[model samples]
Target: MSEKKKGPYKQTGNIAVDMVAACINHYEKQGRKVAYIRLDFIHWTMFKGYVLEQIPAYDLSNGEIEFDDVIVTQGSSLQVKPLYHELVADGKPKVYLMN
Candidate 1:
Protein backbone atom coordinates (compact mmCIF):
# COMPACT_ATOMS: atom_id res chain seq x y z
CA MET A 1 0.00 0.00 0.00
CA SER A 2 1.16 3.52 -0.81
CA GLU A 3 1.33 5.87 2.18
CA LYS A 4 1.19 9.67 2.35
CA LYS A 5 1.59 10.17 6.08
CA LYS A 6 4.12 10.69 8.87
CA GLY A 7 5.17 8.88 12.10
CA PRO A 8 7.64 8.66 14.91
CA TYR A 9 10.52 6.16 14.77
CA LYS A 10 9.53 2.76 16.04
CA GLN A 11 10.86 -0.76 15.53
CA THR A 12 9.46 -4.12 16.52
CA GLY A 13 10.61 -7.69 16.97
CA ASN A 14 14.21 -8.92 17.08
CA ILE A 15 15.01 -7.71 13.56
CA ALA A 16 16.44 -11.16 13.10
CA VAL A 17 18.51 -12.27 10.13
CA ASP A 18 16.08 -15.14 9.48
CA MET A 19 13.89 -12.65 7.58
CA VAL A 20 16.65 -12.31 5.02
CA ALA A 21 16.35 -15.98 4.24
CA ALA A 22 12.60 -15.63 3.63
CA CYS A 23 13.21 -12.83 1.18
CA ILE A 24 15.57 -15.12 -0.60
CA ASN A 25 12.77 -17.67 -0.83
CA HIS A 26 10.39 -15.19 -2.50
CA TYR A 27 13.09 -14.08 -4.87
CA GLU A 28 13.83 -17.65 -5.82
CA LYS A 29 10.13 -18.31 -6.38
CA GLN A 30 9.91 -15.27 -8.62
CA GLY A 31 13.11 -16.27 -10.41
CA ARG A 32 14.43 -12.76 -9.74
CA LYS A 33 16.98 -13.95 -7.16
CA VAL A 34 16.13 -10.89 -5.09
CA ALA A 35 19.20 -8.83 -4.43
CA TYR A 36 17.38 -6.66 -1.90
CA ILE A 37 13.96 -5.55 -0.56
CA ARG A 38 12.51 -2.08 -0.13
CA LEU A 39 10.39 -1.73 3.03
CA ASP A 40 8.20 1.40 3.10
CA PHE A 41 6.82 2.75 6.38
CA ILE A 42 4.48 5.52 7.56
CA HIS A 43 4.14 6.90 11.09
CA TRP A 44 0.92 5.06 12.01
CA THR A 45 0.03 2.27 14.38
CA MET A 46 -2.49 -0.43 13.48
CA PHE A 47 -5.41 -1.00 15.80
CA LYS A 48 -6.62 -4.49 16.68
CA GLY A 49 -9.95 -3.88 14.97
CA TYR A 50 -8.23 -2.57 11.88
CA VAL A 51 -5.89 -5.50 11.91
CA LEU A 52 -8.91 -7.77 11.96
CA GLU A 53 -10.33 -5.99 8.93
CA GLN A 54 -7.07 -5.45 7.02
CA ILE A 55 -4.49 -7.99 8.13
CA PRO A 56 -6.06 -10.83 10.04
CA ALA A 57 -2.81 -12.76 9.83
CA TYR A 58 -1.03 -9.95 11.66
CA ASP A 59 0.83 -11.21 14.70
CA LEU A 60 0.68 -8.57 17.41
CA SER A 61 3.99 -9.82 18.72
CA ASN A 62 5.60 -9.10 15.36
CA GLY A 63 3.38 -6.95 13.17
CA GLU A 64 5.86 -6.73 10.32
CA ILE A 65 6.22 -8.98 7.30
CA GLU A 66 9.58 -10.46 6.42
CA PHE A 67 10.70 -10.42 2.86
CA ASP A 68 14.00 -9.55 1.17
CA ASP A 69 14.63 -6.29 3.08
CA VAL A 70 13.03 -3.56 5.20
CA ILE A 71 13.56 0.11 6.08
CA VAL A 72 12.39 2.47 8.84
CA THR A 73 11.78 6.22 8.94
CA GLN A 74 10.93 8.94 11.50
CA GLY A 75 7.96 11.32 11.26
CA SER A 76 4.46 11.95 12.69
CA SER A 77 2.38 9.04 14.03
CA LEU A 78 -0.94 7.79 12.69
CA GLN A 79 -3.66 5.28 13.55
CA VAL A 80 -2.07 2.68 11.27
CA LYS A 81 1.03 1.95 9.23
CA PRO A 82 0.43 2.78 5.59
CA LEU A 83 3.94 2.28 4.29
CA TYR A 84 6.29 -0.70 4.09
CA HIS A 85 9.92 0.18 3.44
CA GLU A 86 11.59 3.38 4.64
CA LEU A 87 15.35 3.02 4.37
CA VAL A 88 18.16 1.39 6.23
CA ALA A 89 20.11 4.01 8.21
CA ASP A 90 23.40 2.43 7.19
CA GLY A 91 22.65 3.04 3.52
CA LYS A 92 23.17 -0.62 2.67
CA PRO A 93 20.78 -2.48 0.41
CA LYS A 94 19.29 -4.33 3.42
CA VAL A 95 16.53 -2.76 5.60
CA TYR A 96 15.42 -3.53 9.13
CA LEU A 97 11.71 -2.82 9.84
CA MET A 98 11.86 -1.29 13.30
CA ASN A 99 8.25 -0.68 14.65
Candidate 2:
Protein backbone atom coordinates (compact mmCIF):
# COMPACT_ATOMS: atom_id res chain seq x y z
CA MET A 1 0.00 0.00 0.00
CA SER A 2 1.15 3.51 -0.68
CA GLU A 3 1.55 5.61 2.40
CA LYS A 4 0.26 9.13 2.53
CA LYS A 5 2.81 11.83 2.96
CA LYS A 6 2.88 14.08 6.00
CA GLY A 7 3.81 17.54 5.10
CA PRO A 8 5.45 20.73 5.72
CA TYR A 9 2.94 21.71 3.05
CA LYS A 10 3.67 24.68 0.90
CA GLN A 11 1.12 27.47 1.21
CA THR A 12 1.26 30.27 -1.31
CA GLY A 13 -0.72 33.20 -2.63
CA ASN A 14 -0.30 36.58 -4.25
CA ILE A 15 0.06 38.41 -0.93
CA ALA A 16 1.31 37.51 2.52
CA VAL A 17 -2.14 37.92 4.04
CA ASP A 18 -3.66 35.63 1.49
CA MET A 19 -1.04 32.95 2.07
CA VAL A 20 -1.60 33.00 5.83
CA ALA A 21 -5.36 33.02 5.47
CA ALA A 22 -5.19 30.15 3.07
CA CYS A 23 -3.13 28.06 5.48
CA ILE A 24 -5.63 28.65 8.31
CA ASN A 25 -8.54 27.97 6.03
CA HIS A 26 -7.02 24.75 4.76
CA TYR A 27 -6.77 23.35 8.27
CA GLU A 28 -10.25 24.52 9.24
CA LYS A 29 -11.68 22.61 6.33
CA GLN A 30 -10.04 19.44 7.55
CA GLY A 31 -11.49 19.83 11.06
CA ARG A 32 -8.00 20.46 12.39
CA LYS A 33 -6.78 23.59 14.12
CA VAL A 34 -3.50 25.06 13.11
CA ALA A 35 -0.85 24.46 15.74
CA TYR A 36 1.86 26.56 14.20
CA ILE A 37 3.10 28.03 10.98
CA ARG A 38 6.64 27.90 9.64
CA LEU A 39 7.70 30.50 7.17
CA ASP A 40 10.51 30.18 4.68
CA PHE A 41 13.24 32.77 4.44
CA ILE A 42 11.33 34.59 1.71
CA HIS A 43 8.33 35.09 3.96
CA TRP A 44 10.44 35.75 7.02
CA THR A 45 12.11 38.57 5.16
CA MET A 46 8.78 40.13 4.29
CA PHE A 47 7.23 39.90 7.73
CA LYS A 48 10.50 40.35 9.61
CA GLY A 49 9.87 37.26 11.82
CA TYR A 50 6.67 38.63 13.34
CA VAL A 51 3.10 37.81 12.52
CA LEU A 52 0.73 40.56 13.57
CA GLU A 53 -2.55 39.91 15.35
CA GLN A 54 -4.30 41.66 12.52
CA ILE A 55 -3.61 41.70 8.83
CA PRO A 56 -1.85 44.79 7.57
CA ALA A 57 -3.94 47.73 6.33
CA TYR A 58 -1.41 48.95 3.81
CA ASP A 59 -0.54 47.10 0.66
CA LEU A 60 2.50 44.99 1.61
CA SER A 61 3.06 43.89 -1.91
CA ASN A 62 6.39 43.72 -3.55
CA GLY A 63 6.45 41.42 -6.54
CA GLU A 64 8.99 39.40 -4.62
CA ILE A 65 6.43 38.77 -1.88
CA GLU A 66 3.94 37.24 -4.30
CA PHE A 67 5.20 33.71 -3.95
CA ASP A 68 5.62 33.93 -0.19
CA ASP A 69 5.70 30.50 1.42
CA VAL A 70 4.66 28.90 4.72
CA ILE A 71 4.21 25.47 6.23
CA VAL A 72 1.21 24.85 8.45
CA THR A 73 1.37 22.21 11.14
CA GLN A 74 -1.55 21.01 13.24
CA GLY A 75 -2.13 18.82 16.27
CA SER A 76 0.25 18.26 19.18
CA SER A 77 3.72 16.90 19.03
CA LEU A 78 6.88 17.17 21.09
CA GLN A 79 8.51 18.47 17.93
CA VAL A 80 6.12 21.42 17.82
CA LYS A 81 5.48 22.06 21.51
CA PRO A 82 8.31 24.52 21.78
CA LEU A 83 7.13 26.48 18.77
CA TYR A 84 3.82 27.82 20.03
CA HIS A 85 3.12 31.51 20.34
CA GLU A 86 0.77 32.20 23.21
CA LEU A 87 -2.04 34.64 22.77
CA VAL A 88 -4.08 35.67 25.78
CA ALA A 89 -7.64 36.36 24.76
CA ASP A 90 -10.49 36.85 27.24
CA GLY A 91 -8.25 35.52 30.00
CA LYS A 92 -7.67 32.33 28.08
CA PRO A 93 -4.45 31.38 26.44
CA LYS A 94 -4.56 30.21 22.88
CA VAL A 95 -1.61 28.43 21.34
CA TYR A 96 -0.59 29.01 17.80
CA LEU A 97 2.64 29.51 15.89
CA MET A 98 4.72 32.17 14.17
CA ASN A 99 7.96 30.19 14.09
Candidate 3:
Protein backbone atom coordinates (compact mmCIF):
# COMPACT_ATOMS: atom_id res chain seq x y z
CA MET A 1 0.00 0.00 0.00
CA SER A 2 1.67 3.20 -1.13
CA GLU A 3 -0.63 5.80 0.40
CA LYS A 4 -4.24 6.87 0.07
CA LYS A 5 -4.99 10.09 -1.75
CA LYS A 6 -8.06 12.18 -2.58
CA GLY A 7 -9.95 11.06 -5.69
CA PRO A 8 -13.04 9.47 -7.20
CA TYR A 9 -12.82 5.83 -8.16
CA LYS A 10 -12.93 4.70 -11.79
CA GLN A 11 -13.02 1.39 -13.57
CA THR A 12 -9.82 -0.14 -14.90
CA GLY A 13 -10.08 -2.83 -17.57
CA ASN A 14 -7.50 -5.05 -15.98
CA ILE A 15 -8.64 -8.54 -15.08
CA ALA A 16 -5.49 -10.57 -14.80
CA VAL A 17 -7.11 -12.60 -12.08
CA ASP A 18 -9.99 -13.50 -14.36
CA MET A 19 -7.48 -14.32 -17.07
CA VAL A 20 -5.58 -16.69 -14.84
CA ALA A 21 -8.86 -18.33 -13.91
CA ALA A 22 -9.66 -18.72 -17.58
CA CYS A 23 -6.36 -20.37 -18.26
CA ILE A 24 -6.79 -22.72 -15.39
CA ASN A 25 -10.23 -23.69 -16.59
CA HIS A 26 -9.51 -23.65 -20.32
CA TYR A 27 -8.98 -27.38 -20.58
CA GLU A 28 -12.35 -27.91 -19.01
CA LYS A 29 -13.95 -26.32 -22.11
CA GLN A 30 -14.35 -22.85 -20.65
CA GLY A 31 -13.94 -20.05 -23.18
CA ARG A 32 -11.01 -17.62 -23.20
CA LYS A 33 -12.94 -14.95 -21.30
CA VAL A 34 -16.26 -13.27 -21.39
CA ALA A 35 -16.62 -9.60 -22.15
CA TYR A 36 -17.38 -7.68 -19.02
CA ILE A 37 -16.86 -4.16 -17.80
CA ARG A 38 -15.99 -4.78 -14.20
CA LEU A 39 -16.24 -1.70 -12.02
CA ASP A 40 -14.25 -0.79 -8.91
CA PHE A 41 -12.32 2.15 -7.59
CA ILE A 42 -9.13 3.19 -9.32
CA HIS A 43 -8.67 4.50 -5.81
CA TRP A 44 -11.26 4.46 -3.07
CA THR A 45 -11.18 7.63 -1.07
CA MET A 46 -9.37 7.41 2.27
CA PHE A 47 -11.36 9.54 4.64
CA LYS A 48 -10.03 10.18 8.15
CA GLY A 49 -8.29 7.20 6.72
CA TYR A 50 -9.83 3.90 5.85
CA VAL A 51 -11.41 2.89 2.56
CA LEU A 52 -15.11 3.44 3.22
CA GLU A 53 -16.92 3.14 -0.05
CA GLN A 54 -15.71 1.76 -3.33
CA ILE A 55 -16.79 4.80 -5.32
CA PRO A 56 -19.05 7.59 -4.30
CA ALA A 57 -21.82 7.85 -6.83
CA TYR A 58 -21.60 11.20 -8.55
CA ASP A 59 -23.90 13.14 -10.84
CA LEU A 60 -22.10 12.10 -14.00
CA SER A 61 -23.52 10.73 -17.19
CA ASN A 62 -22.72 7.48 -19.06
CA GLY A 63 -22.47 5.69 -15.71
CA GLU A 64 -18.67 6.01 -15.96
CA ILE A 65 -16.11 8.68 -15.34
CA GLU A 66 -12.45 9.10 -16.23
CA PHE A 67 -10.76 9.45 -12.87
CA ASP A 68 -7.11 10.40 -12.49
CA ASP A 69 -7.54 12.30 -9.22
CA VAL A 70 -10.15 13.17 -6.57
CA ILE A 71 -11.39 15.59 -3.94
CA VAL A 72 -12.13 14.87 -0.29
CA THR A 73 -15.81 14.81 0.60
CA GLN A 74 -17.40 15.48 3.96
CA GLY A 75 -18.28 12.82 6.56
CA SER A 76 -14.97 11.02 6.57
CA SER A 77 -15.81 9.18 9.75
CA LEU A 78 -16.47 5.48 9.51
CA GLN A 79 -18.67 3.29 11.69
CA VAL A 80 -15.87 1.35 13.32
CA LYS A 81 -17.84 -0.96 15.57
CA PRO A 82 -19.53 -3.01 12.85
CA LEU A 83 -16.41 -3.17 10.71
CA TYR A 84 -14.32 -4.41 13.62
CA HIS A 85 -16.97 -6.93 14.41
CA GLU A 86 -16.95 -8.19 10.85
CA LEU A 87 -13.19 -8.50 10.85
CA VAL A 88 -13.16 -10.33 14.14
CA ALA A 89 -16.15 -12.49 13.33
CA ASP A 90 -15.43 -13.58 9.77
CA GLY A 91 -12.21 -11.92 8.64
CA LYS A 92 -13.72 -10.04 5.76
CA PRO A 93 -12.81 -6.87 3.83
CA LYS A 94 -9.79 -8.27 2.06
CA VAL A 95 -7.14 -6.00 0.64
CA TYR A 96 -5.54 -6.30 -2.77
CA LEU A 97 -2.76 -4.64 -4.77
CA MET A 98 -3.02 -4.04 -8.51
CA ASN A 99 -0.88 -2.64 -11.23
Candidate 4:
Protein backbone atom coordinates (compact mmCIF):
# COMPACT_ATOMS: atom_id res chain seq x y z
CA MET A 1 0.00 0.00 0.00
CA SER A 2 1.21 3.51 -0.74
CA GLU A 3 1.13 6.25 1.84
CA LYS A 4 -1.01 9.29 1.22
CA LYS A 5 0.70 12.54 0.36
CA LYS A 6 0.31 15.61 2.54
CA GLY A 7 -0.55 18.92 0.95
CA PRO A 8 0.71 22.36 2.00
CA TYR A 9 -1.91 22.50 4.76
CA LYS A 10 0.25 20.26 6.89
CA GLN A 11 0.82 21.21 10.50
CA THR A 12 3.36 23.91 11.39
CA GLY A 13 4.45 25.77 14.50
CA ASN A 14 1.54 28.16 13.93
CA ILE A 15 -0.93 25.66 12.62
CA ALA A 16 -3.87 27.53 14.06
CA VAL A 17 -3.09 30.68 12.14
CA ASP A 18 -2.25 28.74 9.02
CA MET A 19 -5.62 26.99 9.13
CA VAL A 20 -7.40 30.27 9.63
CA ALA A 21 -5.57 31.76 6.67
CA ALA A 22 -6.50 28.83 4.50
CA CYS A 23 -10.17 29.16 5.41
CA ILE A 24 -10.09 32.86 4.69
CA ASN A 25 -8.46 32.26 1.32
CA HIS A 26 -11.00 29.63 0.42
CA TYR A 27 -13.94 31.89 1.25
CA GLU A 28 -12.41 34.85 -0.57
CA LYS A 29 -11.88 32.79 -3.70
CA GLN A 30 -15.54 31.87 -3.69
CA GLY A 31 -16.50 35.53 -3.22
CA ARG A 32 -18.58 34.62 -0.21
CA LYS A 33 -18.52 36.28 3.17
CA VAL A 34 -17.26 34.06 5.95
CA ALA A 35 -19.82 34.08 8.73
CA TYR A 36 -17.67 32.76 11.55
CA ILE A 37 -15.34 30.03 12.77
CA ARG A 38 -15.65 27.95 15.92
CA LEU A 39 -12.57 27.28 18.04
CA ASP A 40 -11.93 25.68 21.40
CA PHE A 41 -11.19 27.84 24.37
CA ILE A 42 -7.47 27.18 24.23
CA HIS A 43 -7.14 27.94 20.53
CA TRP A 44 -9.49 30.86 20.85
CA THR A 45 -7.45 32.33 23.66
CA MET A 46 -4.24 31.74 21.75
CA PHE A 47 -5.64 33.42 18.64
CA LYS A 48 -6.82 36.43 20.63
CA GLY A 49 -3.47 36.74 22.40
CA TYR A 50 -1.61 36.47 19.14
CA VAL A 51 -3.70 39.21 17.65
CA LEU A 52 -3.18 41.46 20.62
CA GLU A 53 0.55 40.88 20.48
CA GLN A 54 0.71 41.88 16.83
CA ILE A 55 -1.87 44.69 16.74
CA PRO A 56 -2.67 45.96 20.19
CA ALA A 57 -5.32 48.23 18.79
CA TYR A 58 -7.26 45.59 16.89
CA ASP A 59 -11.01 45.71 17.41
CA LEU A 60 -12.56 42.31 18.01
CA SER A 61 -15.93 43.31 16.52
CA ASN A 62 -14.51 44.28 13.13
CA GLY A 63 -15.12 40.78 11.67
CA GLU A 64 -11.50 40.42 10.58
CA ILE A 65 -8.99 37.70 11.39
CA GLU A 66 -6.14 39.13 13.45
CA PHE A 67 -3.23 37.64 11.51
CA ASP A 68 -4.04 38.96 8.01
CA ASP A 69 -7.12 41.12 8.51
CA VAL A 70 -9.25 38.59 6.64
CA ILE A 71 -12.82 39.70 7.16
CA VAL A 72 -14.95 37.03 8.86
CA THR A 73 -17.41 37.11 11.69
CA GLN A 74 -15.96 35.22 14.61
CA GLY A 75 -18.03 32.38 16.04
CA SER A 76 -17.97 34.17 19.35
CA SER A 77 -20.70 36.44 18.07
CA LEU A 78 -22.99 33.49 17.62
CA GLN A 79 -22.02 32.01 20.94
CA VAL A 80 -22.51 35.19 22.89
CA LYS A 81 -26.25 34.67 23.14
CA PRO A 82 -28.17 31.60 24.31
CA LEU A 83 -25.86 29.33 22.30
CA TYR A 84 -22.79 30.23 24.31
CA HIS A 85 -24.67 29.86 27.55
CA GLU A 86 -25.87 26.41 26.56
CA LEU A 87 -22.45 25.28 25.27
CA VAL A 88 -20.68 26.48 28.39
CA ALA A 89 -23.23 24.76 30.57
CA ASP A 90 -22.52 21.51 28.76
CA GLY A 91 -18.72 21.93 29.07
CA LYS A 92 -18.21 21.13 25.40
CA PRO A 93 -15.35 22.56 23.43
CA LYS A 94 -16.39 25.22 20.92
CA VAL A 95 -14.01 24.09 18.19
CA TYR A 96 -15.40 23.79 14.67
CA LEU A 97 -14.34 23.48 11.03
CA MET A 98 -13.92 26.85 9.33
CA ASN A 99 -16.10 27.32 6.24
Candidate 5:
Protein backbone atom coordinates (compact mmCIF):
# COMPACT_ATOMS: atom_id res chain seq x y z
CA MET A 1 0.00 0.00 0.00
CA SER A 2 1.13 3.57 -0.65
CA GLU A 3 1.47 5.98 2.24
CA LYS A 4 -0.42 9.27 2.16
CA LYS A 5 1.72 12.23 1.12
CA LYS A 6 2.37 14.81 3.80
CA GLY A 7 1.97 18.61 3.87
CA PRO A 8 0.52 20.75 1.09
CA TYR A 9 2.01 19.26 -2.07
CA LYS A 10 -0.49 16.41 -2.29
CA GLN A 11 -3.40 18.37 -0.86
CA THR A 12 -4.26 19.37 -4.41
CA GLY A 13 -2.96 17.89 -7.64
CA ASN A 14 -2.39 21.49 -8.80
CA ILE A 15 1.16 22.70 -8.24
CA ALA A 16 0.04 26.31 -7.68
CA VAL A 17 -2.15 25.31 -4.78
CA ASP A 18 0.71 23.36 -3.30
CA MET A 19 3.13 26.29 -3.64
CA VAL A 20 0.71 28.80 -2.18
CA ALA A 21 -0.10 26.43 0.66
CA ALA A 22 3.60 26.10 1.44
CA CYS A 23 4.03 29.88 1.35
CA ILE A 24 1.03 30.38 3.61
CA ASN A 25 2.43 27.87 6.04
CA HIS A 26 5.71 29.75 6.14
CA TYR A 27 4.05 33.14 6.75
CA GLU A 28 1.70 31.71 9.36
CA LYS A 29 4.70 30.41 11.26
CA GLN A 30 6.01 33.98 11.35
CA GLY A 31 2.63 35.24 12.63
CA ARG A 32 1.89 37.04 9.38
CA LYS A 33 -1.06 36.99 7.03
CA VAL A 34 -0.36 37.18 3.31
CA ALA A 35 -2.36 40.02 1.77
CA TYR A 36 -0.31 40.36 -1.39
CA ILE A 37 1.50 37.97 -3.71
CA ARG A 38 3.93 39.17 -6.37
CA LEU A 39 5.35 37.19 -9.25
CA ASP A 40 7.86 38.72 -11.59
CA PHE A 41 6.71 38.80 -15.21
CA ILE A 42 9.04 36.15 -16.58
CA HIS A 43 8.02 33.60 -14.02
CA TRP A 44 4.43 34.78 -14.00
CA THR A 45 4.06 33.89 -17.65
CA MET A 46 4.69 30.26 -16.77
CA PHE A 47 3.06 30.36 -13.33
CA LYS A 48 -0.07 32.44 -13.89
CA GLY A 49 -1.88 29.65 -15.69
CA TYR A 50 -1.43 27.26 -12.82
CA VAL A 51 -2.41 29.94 -10.33
CA LEU A 52 -5.50 31.04 -12.21
CA GLU A 53 -6.58 27.47 -12.68
CA GLN A 54 -6.26 26.80 -8.99
CA ILE A 55 -7.90 29.99 -7.72
CA PRO A 56 -11.16 28.18 -7.18
CA ALA A 57 -9.30 25.48 -5.31
CA TYR A 58 -7.96 27.81 -2.65
CA ASP A 59 -8.96 26.80 0.87
CA LEU A 60 -9.60 30.24 2.38
CA SER A 61 -11.63 28.81 5.28
CA ASN A 62 -8.34 27.76 6.85
CA GLY A 63 -7.26 31.43 6.88
CA GLU A 64 -3.74 30.64 5.77
CA ILE A 65 -3.64 31.77 2.18
CA GLU A 66 -5.84 34.86 2.36
CA PHE A 67 -4.14 37.01 -0.24
CA ASP A 68 -6.48 38.46 -2.82
CA ASP A 69 -4.06 41.00 -4.28
CA VAL A 70 -1.74 39.73 -6.95
CA ILE A 71 0.98 41.70 -8.73
CA VAL A 72 2.76 40.76 -11.89
CA THR A 73 5.42 43.13 -13.09
CA GLN A 74 7.95 43.25 -15.90
CA GLY A 75 11.22 44.82 -14.88
CA SER A 76 14.70 44.19 -13.62
CA SER A 77 15.48 43.24 -10.04
CA LEU A 78 16.22 46.91 -9.36
CA GLN A 79 12.62 47.83 -10.07
CA VAL A 80 10.98 44.81 -8.47
CA LYS A 81 13.00 44.70 -5.29
CA PRO A 82 12.13 48.25 -4.30
CA LEU A 83 8.43 47.66 -4.77
CA TYR A 84 8.69 44.60 -2.60
CA HIS A 85 10.48 46.55 0.09
CA GLU A 86 7.87 49.30 -0.09
CA LEU A 87 5.09 46.80 0.48
CA VAL A 88 6.89 45.34 3.45
CA ALA A 89 7.67 48.76 4.84
CA ASP A 90 4.01 49.63 4.59
CA GLY A 91 3.30 46.65 6.84
CA LYS A 92 1.57 44.67 4.16
CA PRO A 93 2.17 40.96 4.47
CA LYS A 94 3.50 39.83 1.10
CA VAL A 95 5.03 36.90 -0.75
CA TYR A 96 7.35 37.55 -3.71
CA LEU A 97 8.05 34.64 -6.02
CA MET A 98 10.94 35.29 -8.38
CA ASN A 99 13.47 33.45 -10.49
Candidate 6:
Protein backbone atom coordinates (compact mmCIF):
# COMPACT_ATOMS: atom_id res chain seq x y z
CA MET A 1 0.00 0.00 0.00
CA SER A 2 1.10 3.54 -0.74
CA GLU A 3 1.02 6.17 1.98
CA LYS A 4 -0.48 9.54 1.28
CA LYS A 5 2.09 12.10 0.25
CA LYS A 6 2.80 14.75 2.86
CA GLY A 7 3.45 18.37 2.17
CA PRO A 8 6.66 20.25 1.42
CA TYR A 9 4.96 23.58 2.02
CA LYS A 10 6.27 27.11 2.04
CA GLN A 11 6.47 29.71 4.86
CA THR A 12 6.85 33.41 5.43
CA GLY A 13 6.25 36.15 8.02
CA ASN A 14 2.87 36.88 6.45
CA ILE A 15 0.91 33.69 6.03
CA ALA A 16 -1.81 35.49 4.11
CA VAL A 17 0.58 36.63 1.42
CA ASP A 18 2.16 33.21 1.30
CA MET A 19 -1.21 31.57 0.77
CA VAL A 20 -2.04 33.94 -2.06
CA ALA A 21 1.29 33.31 -3.71
CA ALA A 22 0.82 29.56 -3.41
CA CYS A 23 -2.66 29.73 -4.90
CA ILE A 24 -1.41 31.81 -7.77
CA ASN A 25 1.39 29.38 -8.43
CA HIS A 26 -0.98 26.44 -8.30
CA TYR A 27 -3.53 27.97 -10.64
CA GLU A 28 -0.90 29.17 -13.05
CA LYS A 29 0.67 25.75 -13.17
CA GLN A 30 -2.68 24.18 -13.95
CA GLY A 31 -3.30 26.71 -16.74
CA ARG A 32 -6.53 27.70 -15.03
CA LYS A 33 -8.26 30.96 -15.74
CA VAL A 34 -8.36 32.87 -12.49
CA ALA A 35 -11.05 35.53 -12.22
CA TYR A 36 -9.49 37.45 -9.33
CA ILE A 37 -7.99 37.04 -5.86
CA ARG A 38 -10.04 38.48 -3.02
CA LEU A 39 -7.98 39.56 -0.03
CA ASP A 40 -10.04 39.69 3.14
CA PHE A 41 -9.28 41.55 6.36
CA ILE A 42 -7.78 44.59 4.68
CA HIS A 43 -9.45 47.97 4.68
CA TRP A 44 -10.31 49.70 1.42
CA THR A 45 -7.99 52.60 2.25
CA MET A 46 -5.15 50.28 3.09
CA PHE A 47 -5.86 48.17 0.02
CA LYS A 48 -5.79 51.19 -2.20
CA GLY A 49 -2.54 52.36 -0.65
CA TYR A 50 -1.01 48.95 -1.10
CA VAL A 51 -2.12 48.81 -4.72
CA LEU A 52 -0.76 52.27 -5.42
CA GLU A 53 2.54 51.23 -3.94
CA GLN A 54 2.68 47.83 -5.61
CA ILE A 55 0.75 48.28 -8.84
CA PRO A 56 1.00 51.72 -10.33
CA ALA A 57 -1.57 51.03 -13.05
CA TYR A 58 -4.26 49.78 -10.65
CA ASP A 59 -7.62 51.60 -10.92
CA LEU A 60 -10.01 51.43 -7.98
CA SER A 61 -13.04 52.13 -10.16
CA ASN A 62 -12.72 48.61 -11.56
CA GLY A 63 -12.03 47.14 -8.11
CA GLU A 64 -9.36 44.87 -9.48
CA ILE A 65 -5.59 44.82 -9.64
CA GLU A 66 -3.30 42.61 -11.63
CA PHE A 67 0.04 41.60 -10.18
CA ASP A 68 2.37 39.07 -11.71
CA ASP A 69 -0.44 37.94 -14.02
CA VAL A 70 -2.90 37.50 -11.16
CA ILE A 71 -5.96 39.69 -10.61
CA VAL A 72 -6.60 40.53 -6.93
CA THR A 73 -9.51 42.11 -5.06
CA GLN A 74 -9.71 43.65 -1.60
CA GLY A 75 -11.29 41.40 1.05
CA SER A 76 -11.74 40.97 4.82
CA SER A 77 -9.33 39.43 7.33
CA LEU A 78 -12.11 37.40 8.92
CA GLN A 79 -12.57 35.52 5.66
CA VAL A 80 -8.87 34.92 5.23
CA LYS A 81 -7.89 33.43 8.60
CA PRO A 82 -10.00 30.32 8.16
CA LEU A 83 -8.35 29.52 4.82
CA TYR A 84 -4.94 30.02 6.36
CA HIS A 85 -5.83 27.72 9.22
CA GLU A 86 -6.95 25.08 6.73
CA LEU A 87 -3.64 25.29 4.96
CA VAL A 88 -1.76 25.06 8.27
CA ALA A 89 -3.76 22.04 9.36
CA ASP A 90 -2.85 20.38 6.07
CA GLY A 91 0.84 20.85 7.02
CA LYS A 92 1.56 23.43 4.36
CA PRO A 93 4.99 25.03 4.72
CA LYS A 94 5.41 28.71 5.48
CA VAL A 95 6.92 29.94 2.25
CA TYR A 96 6.99 33.70 1.71
CA LEU A 97 6.61 34.81 -1.90
CA MET A 98 5.29 38.31 -1.45
CA ASN A 99 6.89 41.61 -0.48
The clash count for each model shown is: 18, 0, 1, 0, 0, 15
Angstrom error of the Cα, residue 23, model 2: value is 0.9
Global local distance difference test of model 5: 0.43
Deviation in angstroms for 54 in model 6?
3.3
lDDT of 1 by residue, 5-93 (tens): 13322233323222333444444455454433433232223223333455576554544433323322222343243333332244447
Q: Which stretches of candidate 6 lie over 4 Å from their true place?
A: 1-18, 43-48, 55-57, 76-99
In terms of lDDT, the poorest run of 10 residues in model 3 is 80-89
Off by over 4 Å in 2: 1-14, 49-99
Q: Each model's TM-score?
A: 0.23, 0.34, 0.16, 0.44, 0.38, 0.43
What would the per-residue lDDT of candidate 3 be over residues 1-99, giving only the tens digit for each residue?
Answer: 113223432323334223222322342243232222222232222221222233444433443222221222222145332111000123357779999
| Candidate 6 lDDT over residue span 30-95, tens digit each | 656445566665533454565576557656688765544555666554574322211112345768
Report the lDDT of model 2 for residue 69. 30
Cα error, candidate 3, residue 9 (Å)? 24
Worst 10 residues of 2 by lDDT: 63-72
How do the candidates rank by lDDT, highest first? 6, 4, 5, 2, 1, 3
Clashing pairs in 3: 7-70
- Candidate 5 on 46-84: residue-level lDDT in tens? 344554464646443432223333222333544454222
What is the per-residue lDDT of model 4 for residues 1-99, given as tens digits with 9 covering 90 to 100? 012224444443554555565665565566553445555455566666666676687787754453333333335533543111011123457788988
TM-score of 6: 0.43
Which of 1 and 6 is ahead in lDDT?
6
Quote model 4's TM-score: 0.44
Best by TM-score: 4
Best by lDDT: 6
lDDT of 3 at 94: 73
